[model samples]
Target: MTAVLSRGRSDAPVRSVPGRPAPRRRPTVAPTWFLLPALVVYALVVLYPSLAGSVLAFTDRSGFDPGEWVGLANFEKLLRDDAARAALTNTVAVAVVITVVQTTLGLLLALALNSAIRARNLMRTLFFAPMMLSPIIVGLLWQYIYTPGGPLDSTLEGLGLGFLTRSWLGSDGALWAIVASIIWHHVGIVMAIYLAGLQSIPPELTEAAQVDGAGAVRRFWYVTRPLLGQSTTIVIALTLTASFKLFDQMFVMTGGGPGVSTQTLSLVMYQQAFVYGEYGYGTAIALVLTMIVAAVVFVQLSITRRGEHQV
Candidate 1:
């Protein structure tokens, strides 16, 4: 009996059962099903519209009047048109100015807010509040401020600086006014993003730098800026995209006025396609705008990606 018991114990498995592997569970099909709704919606909403728009852009469709294929005639006209050329120039100028100015201001704001202060949270909220307003609403609000006898003019007059007041909504001043408003409105958003990035960084690194006799400027230049590579990339991309799509501010504040001085590609597209009756031409301009934005953004992304790897 003792020998039989010893043999049984010896033959036992070290772990659990030789009872057989759990029935190979069939692979779940949920992943495929999970993606089905979004794919279906995208096909209907985005893919179809994009394809149809591309096709429409090839023809000379004057509003509801459909015409035969004009090949690249619309694009040829777009290049030749002076209005389009001016709009393109204005758009580029606004984008470049806003990106640079807004980015610098945002970084400084972020750095300021990251420090300890009594009203830091309040200031953050106040700064961010403007960004939360709708662009159209903001534009409308600024129009009142920009119009003659508005608060801005009143303030100038009150300060005995009335000579500085100009027709902000008219002439080239309109463009500058819009740019200033945009910077003021959106700088907070960029600051918030950078603040988040700053918070994610380890405090010990900056503390260590301080111990090593690094001053504020030098420490930020050497340590903080390099580590903020991702944040900077995000700010640039967002500002670039926003500036390229500029419409609401120009539309409400100046109506692209002082005779097209503030006209942008997006505003031109809207006017051509809907206001006037040149759908095909508008589509061509739209295509060009899309290509320019995509190309520039792609180049920027590539450069940033390379820099990220180096960092």
Candidate 2:
């Protein structure tokens, strides 16, 4: 009987049925859906307005009626008019100065903040606090400081440095003053970004370099700077875009200055649209400004991508 049972068990084989099919692949939680709300908002608020502005740029919508098509007339006038040319020149100059100065100062501040120091948090808060305030508020506040015989000048005089003070918001120096205010306002933001990048770096790498006889500057240049490519990309792109789009400070500080010396493309666009009531021309200027920004971003992106490839 035992031999017969064993034979039967052997012949029966391991009749093991498979378990329930793996739970229907708990549907891949796509992150793309997270972007839906933002995409919708952008389409409605930004994309729609930008498209409408482009259309307006092609039409001379002067009165309450439907705008008449004017084709390239606005652009032609923008190029040919001397005032427009001056505005363009001033815009480029201001943007250049703001970008260069802001980026350099921001990097320096970031490096300083990264260094070990007592009261580091307090110093960081103080440096970055200006960024939290509105640009208009910053402008107004700085205006008081820049005014002749104002707090800054008074302080200079009190310190026996009266010769260093000037009419910061008048004449040719007004543009530089405006640029300085903007830099002070924005440097904090860039510094924060740089600080984040700096902190992300592995301390071991830096320590290893130090152990290998690399000095502070050498360690930063070889280890820290090279690793900071992404941070540099972000800072440069943000600074460039912000510089070109600057308006509030300019408006509040100089109102395009003694002779339109600080009239950025944004300020010119505003003046054309609201002040001069040249809606079509203003739209054209806006379109041009958008194109310039896009071009700059594209160039930066291209350079970043190429650098990535080489790496």
Best-matching candidate per lDDT: 1
Write the residue-wise lDDT of candidate 1 on 143-211 in tens digits. Answer: 899889889999999999999999888867789899999998899999999998899888998999999
* Candidate 1: clashing pairs of residues: none
User: Clash number for model 1?
Assistant: 0
lDDT for model 2, please. Answer: 0.82
lDDT of candidates 1 onward, in order = 0.88, 0.82
lDDT of 2 by residue, 204-237 (tens): 9999999999999999888888777788788888
Local distance difference test, candidate 1 = 0.88
In model 2, the runs with Cα more than 4 Å from the true position are 1-37, 305-311
In candidate 1, where is summed lDDT lowest over 10 consecutive residues?
Answer: 1-10
Off by over 4 Å in 1: 1-33, 309-311
Against the true structure, what is each candidate's TM-score? 0.88, 0.86
